[model samples]
Structures are given as C-alpha cells and as structure tokens.
Target: MSRSAGRSARSEDSAPSDPDARSNGPRIGSDISSNFPDGGQASAGGASLDRAGAKDAPAATIASDSRSNPRNSDPRDILLDALRAALDAVGGYRSVHRRLMQEASIEGPCAAFAVGKASAFMMAGALDALGDRIEKGLVITRHGYAAEVIEPGWPVEVVESSHPLPDASSIEAGRALIDFLRRLPPRTTLLAMISGGASALVERLAAGFGAEDLARVNRYLLGSGYPIGTINRVRKRISLIKAGRLANFIASQEVLNLLISDVPGDDPKVIGSGLLIPHTAADIDTGEIDLPPWLTTMARSAPDLPPAKTMDSIRSEIIARPADARAAAAACLRKAGFDIIEHPEILQGDAVEAGSRIGRMIALAAPATVHLWVGETTVRLPPHPGRGGRCQSLALAAAREIAGKTGAYLLAAGTDGSDGPGEVAGALVDAGSIDRGQSAAPGSCPDRSLRAADAGTWLEACGDLVRTGPTGTNVMDLIIALRARSPASTERSFHAG
Candidate 1:
C-alpha cells in the first residue's frame, strides 16, 4: 500500500541514538525537562496542575495536558503516563501493599514486579502490599528508568536493559532471573512486575540464536510493518524466555503477577510475553506459537533440552491493563462531565492513520458525546535520514485532518513516555494545529506532507505537543477526548483504575 516504510533501525552498538536526543556539546541526550511549562520539574502529579496558567487561552495551547496525553498521548507518552499514573494510582509497592491489606483482600505473600518504562511504577504499586513480607524482588527496566526505586531492606534486584530490541543487558537480566530463582527456597513468594517491554527486558534467546541476530530480525520485521502479533510470533519462536517460558523457572515459587499490558488484546500469552502465564494444557494446545526462521533451524538442530514446564503452583493476575488505564482515562473525562463517547481502544496501529482517523472523527462530530477507545496501533515509517517517533508522527498527521475545525480537543500518547525516540511524550491537536505545527517544524515546511513516520519533524513544528518528561510506564496508547461542538463543556476528564 504505502510505498514500503523505510527500514527500521536495529539495537546495534552503532544504531542511531534516541531520535528525540539533542546534542548538548558532542554527546546526545533525551532530556525533555525544559520542554514543559514550569520547566517540567514539579512534584509527581504537579504536571497537570499547571493547566491553571493556560486556562484563559483560546483553543488550549499547543502544550496542553493530556485529555489531552495522560493514555492517548502517543504510544511513547501513553506508555510513560500510564506508568506514572498506574504507579501513582496504586501508590508504590509498599503503599499498595498497605492499601491492599487494609482495603482489598490480597491473596497471599506473593509480590509483583514489572519490566518496562513502567517497571518502576508497576513495581512501586506491587511493593505497596508485598514490599515488607516478600522474601525478594526483581525489576528489570529500560536503562534510563532504573533510578526511581529507593526501597530499603526488601532486597529488590534491579536491572536496566534495552527495549523493542534486546541487548547484552537482556541476556544478563534473563540469566539473572534464572539465577535468582535458584537461590529461593521452594514455595517462596514471587511478585513479578511484567509489563510491555519485558519482551526485550527478559529476552533469553532460544538456544543458537545470538542477541545480535535477533536484533537484526527485529529490525527487519518492524520495517516490514507487520502487526505486533505477527512480530511477536517470530519473537516468541526465537527467544527461550519469551511467551510463557519465563514462568517455567519459578514453577516452585508462588507467583503474584502484576502486569501492565502493552499488546493490543492484552493476552497473557502476549503481554510482557506471558512470563507468568503457564503454558497449561489449554495454552499449549491453542497458543499456535510462531518463531523466527533461523531460530527454528537452530531449535531443530540444537542439542536436546528439557521442554519448559508451566508451574501450576503459582497464581497470577493482570492487576493493571491497557483497558484499566483506558477506564481510568474515561473516568477522568466523565468526572469532568463532557459528553463522553468511549471508543473501544483506538490506541494501536500506524501513528499517521490512527491520528487521521481520530482527526476526521473529531472533525465530523456534531456536538454529541463521543468517547472513542482504540488500542495498540503502530507507525510504519520510511528510512528517512531524520529524527522522530510514531506518536509525534501521528500528532503531526492528525494536525492536517483537523486543520480548520474549531473547539476540538484531541490527544494521542503512548503508555510509555519514550516513543520510537523522542522526549515530549505526546501532543495536543486542534483546528490551528497546522499553524502551530508549521511553526514547530521551522526547517520543514509544515505543508500537508505525510512524509511517512517523520513525527519528530512534524511535532517539533507544532507547539501543541504534550511533554510529561517520563512517567515511567507502558500500557500501549491512550486517545482520550476530542471536542466536536458539545453543548456543555466540562473542565475535567478522567480514567480511574
């Protein structure tokens, strides 16, 4: 259809650094701290509090909050805000533990751990209840986000790894997970915080597959623009620990899984790659797994290894999910009392198409309640020699659709703050978006040029971008509210879990 999107980048040592990175001196850095109003350094939830200053503005400023980002930011920002909100909503693991013990009936001594940008927050919520009683904890996150936790005496093990693509850190984390379980006694409680990025964080290559080769395959598939399900099929086939394999090691441990879903369906077998879901008889029979080609040859040619065993002794639950985050988002908006039209998770797919679809929908709204919910759309871009992410590209493209429409409040963001490679989580778009977008992208004429995944370029032109820095999470994406002449406009929007 679209001339083949450009070749996707790999995780090689020389792979272009984060696309959102700015060259301060000779080194590149992804620092969005200065991008937000008030320099973006307020208290945890203070980011949204700044809305008061822009209140008097016409057609909310380009840098509007998320109703505006906090799920619908962009895949990157949605991922980021979801982490922060989920973490903040449940509080940290210690606080969550206290609340659960006092509020809901927590089943047992198990703890929870997540692997993603949201790993910290997911872990934070998990530790809320299990922090003190749990024997040990393990959290693996993308490199930059490993600094959020400061738990004492809980003996939580933290590992910083790569994402979308695996690296040595992935190998280390996976092996460490296996080694850590070895030290635990039978029947010990395990609180696993497995989020979207776990596929990379916990990746242990299927024997014979090198991390480098796997990275190559990932690069190829992403550029191929295949659905995530198809990509994961190949990923699961090539990796030893993905799918349900990670859960096999803790067969002897009691597991309480706290997951933050990133995949479209949030299937346990796919979310964070079903690390805790046992490949039960049912799963094994119907999972219909897929693996990489070279990997299959390796699997067949390699020496015999014991088949992975799913532990029936452990228990797991999807404590936090994309749907949960969507609900939380819906609640926030409904509380604000705008005519709510909840779309069923329009958070996934090509950034440009998703944005255009929502933009067109917002443009056509006839002053009614329209809450659209979509999830897990992807952006397949060309190999342009430029810098940007899928969310930014979506916002840029959406800007064109809503070029002349007034009174529209549209937002798109990733649950994870880091979209492909930028810092301003997601963005806000409306009628004047093109003007702002053109201004934002001073170098590139903000003309109607889809230009394929050049979100970085488009976003830079429009000041209506929403940047929460890093909310430290991943849920997929959130596209909350877009105004279309509603008779009554409410000031608040919500999605409470």
Candidate 2:
C-alpha cells in the first residue's frame, strides 16, 4: 500500500465553509489569531490557545479562586499551565502569522513547504494569512503530530514520518519535497516553515548512501549523547538536501524562511540541519567533534561536494525560540505570586547530573520559589538501554534527591509533547515519587532503573509521568521546580493528572 494511501488530495474550492462542522479527517478553521492580540504580543500570564485555537483560562488563574491562593493549588497544574502559556507564546501559528504579516509586499502565487513537528499548525497559519496567495503547499511532520490543522480538502499534501530517526517514509517525503520544489513555476515566492525534527522527518541521502546507513549514523549520534548541534553537523555532511542544498532547487526565487528554533543559539544554520542555510568550513569541521571510528569511516567514505553558496534571495528569521518559552513560563509563575529564579544560560551535559544539581538547588531554595530552566540535555545510552528520554532520566535522578522531602516538586518535559521513544511527554516528580514507585512495584529498584535509563517505567509505576501527546511545538525542554511556603504542611502524594 502507498504510504499516503488514506489521504486524498483536494482543491481549496472544495473546503467547507465551516471546517469544524465536519466529522471526517482532522478539522481546520480555528481562529488562532485570538491567542495573540495586538499582532502576536501576548498578555502577561494570559490565556493560551489550544491546538484548535480555543482560548484557555490564564494558567495563573487556574491555581486560585482569584489570584491570592496559588500556593494551595497543585504543582502539576501550575507547571502544566506554565507550559501551556509558554507554548502559546511561541506557537507556530502565531510565529508564522506574525512573520507573514510583516512581509505584506510579497504577493500571491506562493508555494509553502512546512517541515517539522509544528508543520501542520504553521501551515494553518500560512493558509489563514496567505489564503489564495498560496497556490500550493506541502506539510511534512512526525507521525501523530498532524492534529486538527490539516483537512481533506486543502491545497497541500501532508506526509507523516518518523522522528529522531529516519525510516523509509522519510526518504519518500524527501523525494516528494524535492519534486514539489522543482515543479514550482518561475517567479513564485517560496515560504519555508521550518522547526525542530525536520532533520529526521525528511532526508535525501547523497550518492552511495542508503536508508540503513542514514539510520545507523543517526542512531550512533543520538546514543553517543552528542549535542543536537553536533548531530546536525554530522547529518549535513552526508545529505543531499540539508546544509542549504535545498536552495539549489529554488532557481533564484525569493524565499522566506521562518524558523521556530529548537537549538541552543537559535542558529538557522543548525536548526533542522540548515535545510536552506549554507554551511561554512567551520560548520562542517568534525576534527573537534570526537567522532567514533565507524562514523569517521562513514564520513570519509561519503562523496565530497563543492562548497555551499550563500543565497541573497533567501531571507530567514527566527520566529520563536527556547528563550521565548522560558520567559512565558516565568511570567506566568511570577503572576501567580511565586518568586522566580530564572536561569538564562542553556543547560547541557548529563541528564542525571543536571537533575541532581537542580534537586539540591530546590532543596535549598527559599519558600514559594519557582526555579525555571530551559535547554536540551543529553543521555548516553548503554549497549542495551531501557526506555526513557533525557527528561525522564533527569526527573528520576532528581526523585532520589527529594525522595522523602516535603513541599517540593519538579516537572521535566519536552515542549514538543513526546519524549524519546514513548507517547508520554515526561514526568512530574514530588517528594514521595520514589516511595510511590517502590510501592507500585515492590520488587523493582529505582536505582537499577535509573542506571539502565528506564526512568519512564519507574515514573509510570509511580503515577508521575506527564503525557501530552504532540503539543504542536518544539522548543527544547522545560524544567520547573516549585517549593511551597510551609514544608511541614505541604506533604502531598504524587499526582499524575
């Protein structure tokens, strides 16, 4: 069967007047603009927009009857609310809309290609903003992330594929994307919506490389615990589409690249492996990257190409980033009367170590304090590692530090909603998390699980896992730690809800 068998293509004219009225396929026509009043300037601790564009009550307000008793509310609720606010502040819809609105001079007959976890939502914003101007479009997103943003009758092709690792579908999506770009008529403006996960969602390998080789390289890099920047650098060395090679197909057409940065420095060249941005000699310099023998052999064996040329016609802008999400979350917590301890620097290195340090900091923090951290962490997988991502590992490590404490909780989750190999996003662990895990499985050992990189299993056994399927955005990870006013009075059990 074809990979895109069930999804039939349709023209824009066939779209229903009220998309929400349809019961088939994913619904559309959500009023996403409502979330960003005053042209994408969000209100402080304000209402967030759901995937369907419905406004949720302000997260700060969710914790209290009015605003005086946020301390009484659940830490999980507060963290989740802050996450919502952060996501809303940097949503793909708002980012794309705001950027498109700025380029009012660019006229119709535009071709849009959105690739990443946020493709569908970004495409929705493009459809709303560009309308008939967008003559053709394509969306490439991770499996299960194309939620409610694309419908049956739309002038776009939606392809869902694997993420963090490429499969056969990824290669097929790459071919389709290349064909789409090549088929565009002359003088057509191209709008590229890029975000995290594009590196794996679509790939076109260079000559002499196959799908297995691509998977092998990705697997090695991921398990090696190399930062995303390094992994992307390796990926660009062997790809035909990445590292600005996609620009070769555009034929000098004016290109607008709007990106939602998932990298530490918000570098368009590293985000999504720089699909439309050229790589410098230093960018591909792997001498300092400490590549393994097999990877070095693979890199050396791959055919070399000429240096990538810089394009003047293409204009790129970072619409959203990790800093934006962190700021949004901090603002919400501050409005809820929590003393914020914001960490502006990016958190890196081992997940377990980071968690241990964060746990110790939370233990010593003042009452009613909320410590917020935003950055990506890495986990070095064993020969046969167990289930769990970096976030889960961090949460479990922290659980050990606060196993029997009171009035303290920590939430570690990926903003993209899915973490590692599981559907669950991350975990929310409290003082009793370790005990709950021990109670759920009497014979099981938390230490063993943590060492084996199976924190998801322990967290699940303890009912502390946080599952938010495909949050429609990718802005690295968010870690929130809360310390209550009275430790003696705040001994509460773990609540996953």
Candidate 3:
C-alpha cells in the first residue's frame, strides 16, 4: 500500500467506536477518556470572552467542592479518596490563591498565562488573588477544560488544546500565546502559571518546521522509553518559547513563575519547558543528553534558541511536588491503621520491570503493610499496540507477579486522571484480575499483553480498569501496594472499590 493509503487505513481502524471518545487525533481504543466535562468558571472576579468566539459572557465563580470524599469504608475507596485529597492539597486552586494573595503585589498591571491540566484552576486562583490588578490573561489547557461559559466582564481568554501530543489546536494556542506576549510592554509583569502538560499544550514552531514535524518528534520521544527531562531538552532546543525563551522576550520585566511540579526533581527548568527560567551557560555545558540522530540535528539546527538572559527579574517556586502527594497518602493510610512503607527514590525506568519488582516486594512484605511510590514510567510501544498506558501496563505486570496470591492488591494511576490514550485513569489489580484474564480467553496471559503493550485490553476484560475522568491536576503517577491478612490473622483485607 502507498504510505498515504496505509496511513488512512490505520487512522480508520483506530477511530474510536464510543460516542464520547476524545478526538484529539486518530488513536486506538483506550480505557481513559480525554473528553472530560468542562470545569465551570474558576473565578467570578472578572469579565471574560467565550472560547468559541469573542462574545460577551457572564463572569463565573470557582467552586471549592471536590469529587473525592467517599462514604464507604472500602480500603480501595479510602486509598483513592486519599489520593484525591493529596491532589487537592497540592494542586488545588485555594492553595494557589492563598499563595498569590500573600506575596507582595506587582507594581503595575500584570498579565497571567496558565497552561496545563490544572490551568483552569490555577488561572482562577490567580484571578481571585490578583483581582482587578490583572488587566488581562490567557489560559491554554487540554480539550474539555473550557466547557463552561464565563461572565460578560471577565478579561481572561481560555483556549483548549491537545496534550501529550500537539495537534491543530496546539498550533493555534501557540500562536495566540506568542501574539499576546509580543504586545506586552517591557515593564509589565508577567505571571505564568505552569504545570505538567504545558510542553505539548503550548508551542511555537521553529523556522521551516511545521506542526507535523513537531508532533512526530514528540511521538518518537514519548515512545522511546527515555526520561522526560531528556525529551524536554530536545523540545527546548527546537522551539521559540521554551528553555526560558519566553522570559528572554519580556526583557527587564519581572516574571513570577509558579509551578505545581509533575517531574521528579521539581526543577522549574524542566517544568513547562522552563518558559520563564533561562538556562545558564553552565547548564548547557553540564552532563550530556543522548537523543536520536534526527532529533539531535533538529535540536542543533532549530532557529531562534533563547539567548541566555543576564537580568535578575525572574523568580520561581514550586508550589507542589510528589513528596507532598506521597506524604498525604502516608498520613491517610496511617490513619486507617496500615503501616506505611515509603520508598525514598522516585520510581523510574521501564513499566513492566519496575512493576514486577515492586509487586514482588509488596507480596513478600508483612500483612497490613501499605507501600507507596511516585514517578512516571515509560513503555516502548510495538507497531499498532492496543489500548493501554504506562500505568495500566504497570498494573498488569504487577498482577502477573501477584497471581494466585490472596489479598495482594495494586492501584496504579496517573494523578492527572487520564493515562495514555484512554478515557480511564489507570487500574486496580488483584489476584482476581489474573483469574478473570485466564477465564476471559483460554491461554490469554498478562505476559502476552505486556509484551504487546496491550495491557488495557486484557485489563478491561478482567474488569480491573479504574476511571475518574479528569481530576483537574497532574503530578505524575501514584502506586498503592497492599498485602492481604495472613491466613491465620483476623483482620480484613482491603476490598477493591
């Protein structure tokens, strides 16, 4: 088949059968739905424009209610609920609002630009804190983030864009951001609210490069099993706004960069591609980053790399991190009487290997023990791999390790609420998951699915997948490991939710 014909065929085959599937691009059926319900207006402090057009709308208010709080005593329910609280505590709008309110006010009118999974909430917090002091702002977030209408007098403009990969919407968002920044005066303060998905949500193409090229590069890097820092360094080298380029453009303006970190080190330079933090000469000289030949060439040849900024106008702080999330989980589990086992190092490397290793550790641990870990995992996808994400695959691999063992359970999920291309967040797996997989298809095994990177298919058949839609936050993945009561013990094991 011709290349174009092959591409068309693949696209057709991967089209979602579900009516509610997110249409960011053609991809196979996955458990997680990216088409989340729109978060209603985060703040009613100012007037605004509808995303579909520049028409007037009523100002909106941000509700403080959260979806987590469970009434059941189920261990899974408690664990998941605790996670929600953790996410809320770290990435919640109230925290950002409080922080902004406490900080010394900007001298003149300020402009805020928020980008990522938590963009709406973060932007809302800025508005509530800054009030009429913020003359105008822009928010570039994932699809479905801007579903509600804003009040007529609100000044911020919200744009929904593709995430984890750049699409047409991403291109438009990038153009909008660049245009907005270009119009600001040198003395105007710029407040950038950044989180995990900003790397893909906002972009400005280098000269002679198109969105397709950028998308292709991102896909290759995502599936390469390389760490995010490596992927972002290459990304920074190829764009006009990344690696502190945006800060360089503001020239002499005070820039306050607030972040809810989703990366391991919580380094602002890697977060949101370091939009407001310029890389120093020493940083460029530090330890090498290995990438594919094509990516290296593109990184080297890309036009308009951000020149190192010497001004001291930029300041940054991490509002949240994985440690904070893990701490919350530990506190919650301890309250429930489970002895928590915390791993010091952030989990890393391939999904299957990591999951298998962690699963074995949990299985052999003492009864009533809870193991918690946080970090991102990578999967090397096979050609046309079936629906599944790194977290799902990790859970499946862990399932295989704990097969036939009673009371062994694992909950693996992304805090952002969507994992990979699926509508579901991740999965909750136990010994029964293996039993269901075996009964669903004779001779079908988690090993086979793991090999194919098709864990979601097998997991769905086992009824082990977990879904929470979009939680309006992203801080990497969280894993909960628990062992059942000893055979002679009287205590009850954690029941799945």
Candidate 4:
C-alpha cells in the first residue's frame, strides 16, 4: 500500500510535552523510521532529546572549601534544573509524533488541526513524522510560541490568539477552523491535536452568543476560583466547537487524536474542553454547586444537547500528563543525591492556603529532602486585583511561612512559562523572600501584597520571579520544596535507606 492510504491520527494536545523516543527512556518502536516523510529525510528535530535540556551539562555542586564559587549547591537551583529536565522530557513535539508513527501505519494523505499552547510543537512533530503527507494544516496557539516550533516555509496556516480568555480573534479562528474542516477533500483523514488554552484560543459560540459573552464568562470563571473541571464544563455548554461539537462536522472521516492532558485524571473529554470528544449524560449533571448568577442563568437558558456522535470514529490517546512530568523530575532529583518526598495528592483550592500548607510541610522535613506537588490551584480575585497569578500568590504565602527559617526554599510556577498577568512563570521563595518583600515596601507586610494580588510586584522586587517565556506546553503547576541538608542529616538519610 502507498504511504498515505489507510491510516489515521489524532491527539489530545493540551497538557505538556513528551519524553525521548529512543531506548533507555520510552520508545514506541523502530517502525516509525520507515514512515518518515520524504523518504525518511524529514528531521524529527522538534522531538529531539536536546530540546529536553539533556544537552546542557548538569550543574555541579560547589565544594565546601572552594572560594571561587562560594554560592554552594543551591537546592533551589538543583530543583529548578530538575524541573526543566522534566519539562523537556515531555515538552517536545517530535517525541509524541514519533510515538504515533510507530504505532500506526499511514496509507494516505492527511490533514490536521492542532490547537492549544503546545500546538506548534505538536504540528512540527506531525509534519516531521508524516512528511508532506500532511496536506493541509491549521495551527492556533498563544502568542510567542508559534515562531519557535514552526520552521520557515512551513505550509500550515497559523493563527496567534489570546489565551486564558476567549476574544474576537478566538471566534475568528474558530470560524476559520470550521471552514477548513468543511473544505477537506472527501475521504481525507484527519489528525486533530488538542491541548490546554484551546478553549480560549479557538471557539465558535452557540446561538445568541458572541466573543463578549465568552469573555465575560471566562473572566468570571477566572476570578471565581472554580476548579478547572467546573470552568471547562461551562465552556463546553456555551461553545459550538467544544464538548465534541468540533468532531460532529467531520462526518464519517476517521480521526486520530493524541492528547497532552493538563486537567486532572487526563480525561480526553475535559482537555481543551473536549474539542473532539463529547460529554456523557453524567457529565451534564453537575450536582448542586454554587455558580455565579450569570453562569446559572446561562446554564439554565442554554439548550442541553447530547454529547457529540463522533466519539466512535475518533480514537484518542493521552501522550503526556503531570505524572509523566513528576516521574522525570523525580529521576533528576535522585541523580542529584537528594531524598525525594513525592506527595501523590494533587494540589487544589486556594493558592495561598495551599502554599502555606506546603511550606509548613517543608519546614518539618529533614534537611536535603525535596518535596514535590503537581496540579493547578485556583485564586479568588479581589476587586481590582493587582498584577499576579496563582503561582505568585502561592510563593508569597509560602514566604510568610518560611520567614526566618533556615535553609528552606520553594518554587511555585506554571509549567507553561507564564504565571498571572506578567511574564514570570512563577517564583522561588526562601526565608528571605518575606524580608525582600518587606524591604521593597517598608510600610507593608509581605502578606499585604498577597492580599492585594500584587505578589508579582513583591516577587519582582525580591528578584525571585521565574521567567522562561512559553515552554511550548501546558500541564499545570509544579511546586518544589527543598530543605538544605547538613552533613549529619545526609548521613542519617543514607543510614535510614
């Protein structure tokens, strides 16, 4: 059979990245080598190991007697390096694509629509694996990420749009995508990549709805401190493209969807607001919950529809999730000779409360023990809130707990390379974090900034903001806590093990 005839592809694209595709890590198989477009010549550079930070030599621990590098082996630096490794392990586009190619045999021309924060890398990987067989494609991503993953002269139509909230551009992109889906030649297979931010990056509103409606709802949700599931459920109710509605337009055409799950449980029906999968009846039954008046009104007024009928034609796989990131990070931590304390419970609810709880946990741990937590946190916004996101808020709260404590530090950040309204992805808070905030604002307590939603301001002043501009993926937030270990503590841990 010819290369493009019988196969299909689709991925839930929103969560985060993928790991190395070769042996010694995770490998699909060698069959993909033969499927490469252009007779195996298309470089799968986008999915390579170098992108995962493996190429950078690991930072060496400072010797106790050395005066040249007196800064000692910072636990914060070690943890951050491990965090980067974790992101890189899963954040590559090439890795996911290569995995799919190894599992499926492509026989005919294919079209793809990749949407979310990770869209560009996902598209790059798809193109590399399938070669020019990807006849037509559309990429919708947040600003600043497309340029890095999309090679010059690449054929896909690309759109950069707003995120965390839908805008007019999001509606435009949605309409364009519907048109693109409709225009695909008969019998053409589709590969749809769905990732986080998709609900905001692309949308086709239901009747009587517009961008303003979505914007208002999203704003309310953002400020409401609702769980992601609740927020996305509302989104699915209002969107013509979400909750598997997008898949309805495909008719009988086969679809293969690969997903990166940012939502807890990695449910394909929830990622990207289930752009390609429909909700079940149980999904529609959101039990007694307090929703804003506007949302309640909308929910009651919005027509209830059955889940999309296209679930049968499309096959879905979760390529990456928080667990994958945690595992990667844990591996790095072990290599660094630290005792890792992994809390399996996902962090949730108020950011500040969560941070304080975690801070207390760290303060009680033995020195040299690293604590890690993964999951998204919600923040209830006060009126006219200041410039900061949940990560900043959490960092500031932790700062209050660790103040005056010796050798304790924490990092709270979004894996997507941004936190709140600022460029900072998150913050690293130490015992000095509180002092820094105080020194920056002499009349105020550090908690004041947290209360005002201006944690970013304080974090910036303290030189604790972590900025890495769009990591090309989105999972959730990663929190790492490190307690500096003394020689006695290290020996104890070794003995206990």
Number of the predicted model whose lDDT against the real structure is largest = 2
Model 3, range 1-497, lDDT digits (tens) per residue?
12233223224254322211311211111122323223323112111222332211112221222322233334455555455545555653544665776788575688888888878767755665565677878888888764442233457788899877787688788889887877887678888889889988988766667788787887897678766556666677777777777754564357787888898888888788787776764443313766667666666664553554433677888887878878877887777667898886888899999889878987787877889999999897888788889999999999988888777888898877777896767888887788898898788877888989999999888877776555556789988888755644423333432
Error of 2 at 397 (Å): 1.4
> Model 2 reaches what TM-score against the true structure?
0.80
TM value for model 1 = 0.73
Q: After best superposition, candidate 3 residue 175: deviation in angstroms?
A: 1.8
- List, residue by residue over 1-497, the lDDT tens digit for candidate 2: 11122121112343332322221211111011112232222211222333323322222111122322234355556666676678766777666755675677678688899999988778866765576678789999998676445655568899898877798889988988999988998788899999999988998876666778777887788688786668767887767787787787786458889899998888888788888886666777677878878677766664444344437688888998999999988998887667998998998899999999998888777878999988888887777889899999999988888877787789888887777887877888889989989999998887789788889899888877766555567899999888866634333311212
State the C-alpha lDDT per candidate: 0.52, 0.72, 0.68, 0.69
- For 12-80, candidate 4 gives per-residue lDDT tens digits of 132122324231221111111101122111111223222221211111111121111123245555666
| Best-to-worst ranking by lDDT | 2, 4, 3, 1
Candidates ranked by TM-score: 2, 4, 3, 1
In terms of lDDT, the poorest run of 10 residues in model 1 is 1-10
lDDT of 1 at 253: 41
lDDT of 1 by residue, 28-74 (tens): 11112321244322222111112222100000012323333433422
In model 2, residue pairs whose N, Cα or C atoms come closer than 3 Å (at least 3 residues apart or on different chains), thus clashing, are: none
Candidate 3 accuracy as TM-score: 0.77
Residue 102, candidate 3: C-alpha displacement in angstroms: 1.9
Which is the better candidate, 1 or 3, if ranked by TM-score? 3
1 against 3, candidate with superior lDDT: 3
Name the candidate, 2 or 4, with the larger lDDT value: 2
